[model samples]
Target chain A: MRLIHAATGEGFNPPSAKDFELPPFIEGVDWATKPILLAFLSVIFISVFFIAASRKAAVVPSKLQFAGEGVYNFVREGLGREIIGHDFLKFVPYLFTLFTFILVNNFFGIIPFLQFPTMSRVSFPYVLAAITFFIFHYVGIKKQGIVKYLREIMFMPGVPKPVYILLTPIEIATYFLVRPLTLSLRLFANMFAGHLLLLVFFLGGEHLLNGVLGLKLVSPFAFVIGIGLTFFEFMVQVLQAYIFTLLTALYIAGALADEH
Target chain B: MNKDENALWSIFGYLLSGLLVWGGIGYFVDRWLGYDRVFTLVGLLLGMGSALYLVWLRFGRHSG
Candidate 1:
């Protein structure tokens, strides 16, 4: 929607998909963008925090140690143990890293001066999902031999022979294509939409201010809603991270399960 | 929160892929055969039906 003030002759350009097409920080370096920079920063930040938290290990734990261990134990017990079952220990490191990395980068969306969620850039989620896809499939292949794994995935027992024609392709697609695609798309779509929602309110509020006196009064309402939604977005960010990690664990669990 | 809730997502994935893969084939067939939306609709119906059946086989049969 275009908001044009007749008297001022200034038009409000509503935020669109164009807003997501961020420009490079460097003049000519196409890959040097805000999302890439923030992703690197998130990795560094997580590493530093965890390293520092564990550096001073004590029986009577320090606050930082408690916090670090809190996050670690939560992922290890809550996610890795409960979801992944008996052989959960080996996957803890991967699950822990995935949770913390996603949580940190997602929180960047609401952080001042670093307002973009890295996953909003679809490529980041694509890479994460690809890693998850390979890891789970590899785990399955290792657990079950290639022929057995393929058989289990392709043919669900108890199904009639004639039905295999209809169901086999769906089964293959669900495992290989659908799983990773949905995983990445879910994260990417949520972050993309959340950022866009915030942009609509905040940008609309800003544009409203440059209007007549009546519109100026309405701007505060927009800002208020924007602030409220920021809190909502924070909850969503955490949930999305949790869900992504949880699903990864679930996929691993499914792969490791002996029976289909 | 529970494993069942997570299975719900798998059901969704199954249904989505079913529609996409089958309907996609239909669309391509239509393009190849120079037909309008005839196969596309048939493919979508076939997809939805098969997807529901698949879901029943995976999840529903366990209960009943």
Candidate 2:
């Protein structure tokens, strides 16, 4: 039992959250890290792709044109139109930019040589949520007027007077704090956990290769699961991006509605 | 399309805020009055109940 414990404990250097703490590329510059560089690359890549795809302006779109149009239509028709109703067109540009930007950044996790999802860093998602937070509140203020909006949020029309004390604080807390917190946390947690999972399988497989006979024999299974999970992670990454954008649209719709 | 997705997040937000706001209130009340964990438990259950009721009002009635 002791020998087995030692082998398992010493041999297995399981990946933890610490592994995500990548140091800056330059010695003194704190801003330059792997994820930061990957984010910049994602922006450049997305910009160039869309610009090239649209430059020709053909009546009948070629393969590249079709691909760009497909993505645009998906967001406009599926999310913006369904969620925002008549105001959908006004918000499509924001939704399109958000969807494509998040999708590409998430895809970076599985890409060769650049295996890092920028959204996993937490700050990226926080910033995105912050922008959505502002947009929705601004829309609400603009549409309902600030006084009516605040009154609607704090006081439900049907509730009793005594119960207002109980319900109003909860409502305030939910809108101001919990909404943005969960919005950012959901995306960050998914990417962070997915990346950590992949690292464990790959790293464990490599470690097993250097172990005794029994471990060596089992290493291939670890690698096989690792390979399978890469594909699974791709699906999850896409879904997370879609969910994030979908929620943003819904929030905007909620803000625009006359009632709370 | 809109209500279903929004409902999920809204439910989550309601539950979280319920716990934080009510639970914090209970905690401070207990510290002030020196109760032996009574108010904290009461506060949590109250929070959860109200949160679920809020969810029912917001989403269940609408059915979308």
Candidate 3:
């Protein structure tokens, strides 16, 4: 009697970084071409959509107006209010832009042809992180004056002299080194991992269905898992976008606050 | 030394905690997804690699 090989059958090649490649646009620009195009296209699309939506102001509001207002209010109230406090409204535009830009790019990752998440490329998220870093630091220095802000950041009120010697170096390292690193990595890693997982499940399912025999029964299971993972990826796409913006606000709040 | 420095330090603390919490979550998610120990191990390596690169940038490259 012949036994069915479940795990031994030809399985789908697990998705790797190489699987996600961008087509070349011209001669010298190969990898960078697609991302640049996507970024430019995203900016144009978002700008056009918002500008068109708000072009006409109505008392009752049209479908476009509703969309604009809903997105604006959601980012302003849900994320900004919760994280940035009273001054949240001031940064609404930046926050809205960040959210919409990231959300669109992330959704692009799952789209059939445009399968690259711009943020997954380190440079994209690094730029945002640098912007946040500069904004918060500038606000801290400008609001408190450079001297006062320095004092607030490095010297706490209650620590002992001996503790200061030990803690000061650690504190200094944390401020100058870790902040931007985490900021960039959080968004980058999330998009990278989420995309990788979706690739694995979908590609794995395809491979199992087509490449293997007798183990065809497992194809149904792989399909179910693939479907389930896609739904989860959708949730993650939104959540990561929210978390990225939320953390930016939180960092800004830290810069703006006086104590604690 | 000064209030601005203290604020910076405080913000850094907040950032560190945030990173630790989120990174820990990602690590656990990899474990839960049945990727075996390899996922967590890869994350650890990535974290260390990032940390080393950051140190090199901040201290090694910038000092000159």
Candidate 4:
């Protein structure tokens, strides 16, 4: 870490992972964190948005209704029909819910006065990943008998019997460990890093404003760049949410799939 | 967006999980046996090989 003093006062304290550890809004309550509140707000926001969007649907839809239907059709045809095959309808609700929930919650990062992304809290993504994990495995088990599912996972065709000893552990680890871990980590990491990036540029700009007159002049560039990155962050947030839901749908499709 | 992208992500997940799981198991085995670096290396190589094979089986065989 380089220590560069601004000649005006103390060195700037760069944002660290510690900034993520936001203090509880309510005293003496372990569960009263900003992420929890944001998560609840997100749920309410999603519920209200969708209900209002659909409540007054007519022959010629309004802009809000069109927007809602656009999102639905995207997931329905793009993800569900393509991935889940003939049984796509059964999972559209789940996929839609997952997509909207994540997309809304992720947008919290950019929304004014609610700059925190709830998924960056780590456990949120973990729970979401855990849900997909359980749902897919259960679907697979129910679709194929337990023994057959396990057998299919553990042994792939065209591989020699001796190689089974090598491949089985990898397959099991990928299915039972890798899939969910990556799913959660990908979302968590993107949000965490995006938040940190914003924090860096914005905070750095503030720090620069307090510096020597020469340094203060360059602060606007930092601010401008920070503004630019926010739009990039928006793109990343949408992409991450899409990827997470897409992977969930893919897993379900894989579970329902007959063979390799 | 397409089937290849799905396969690509799956491949990455499989490769990472293989390394983490087997390499972790190998680390534990090393600690138990007091070997210097043999088990860990073997575990990693085994994991990488098997993961690539699994990727080939799932993506390669299916597409072609």
* Each prediction's TM-score versus the true structure: 0.95, 0.94, 0.74, 0.94
Q: How much lDDT does each candidate structure score?
A: 0.92, 0.88, 0.71, 0.89
> A1-260, model 2: which lDDT tens digit per residue?
01233465655667777788999999999999998898889889999998978889799998898898899899999999888999889889888999998999999999988899999999999999999999999999999999999998887776668877778889999988888888899999999999999998999899999988999999999999999999999999999999999989998999999975
Q: Can you tell me which runs of candidate 1 are displaced by over 4 Å?
A: A1-9
Best candidate, lDDT: 1
Angstrom error at residue A217, model 3: 2.7
Q: What shift in Å separates residue A112 of candidate 2 from its native position after superposition?
A: 1.3
What lDDT does model 3 reach?
0.71
Q: Indicate the worst ten consecutive residues by lDDT in candidate 3 chain A.
A: A163-172
When summed lDDT is taken over every stretch of 10 residues in candidate 1 chain A, the lowest stretch is A1-10
TM-scores of the first chain across all predictions? 0.95, 0.95, 0.88, 0.95
| TM-score leader | 1
Error of 1 at A47 (Å): 0.6
Model 3 C-alpha lDDT per residue in residues A49-116, reported as the tens digit of each score: 99988999799999999998899889988777876788778788888999999998878877778877
For residue A127, what is the lDDT in candidate 2?
93
TM-score: model 1 vs. ground truth? 0.95
| lDDT for predicted candidate 1 compared with the true structure | 0.92
Instruction: Pick the winner on DockQ between candidates 2 and 4.
Output: 2
Per-model RMSD to reference? 2.4, 3.0, 11.3, 2.4
lDDT at position A48, candidate 1: 98
Candidate 4: which stretches are off by over 4 Å?
Answer: A1-9, B61-63
Residue-by-residue lDDT tens digits, candidate 4, A56-140: 9988999999998999999999999988889889889989988988898889999888998989889999999999999999999
Enumerate residue pairs that collide in model 4: none
Cα displacement (angstroms), candidate 2, residue A242, comes to 0.3
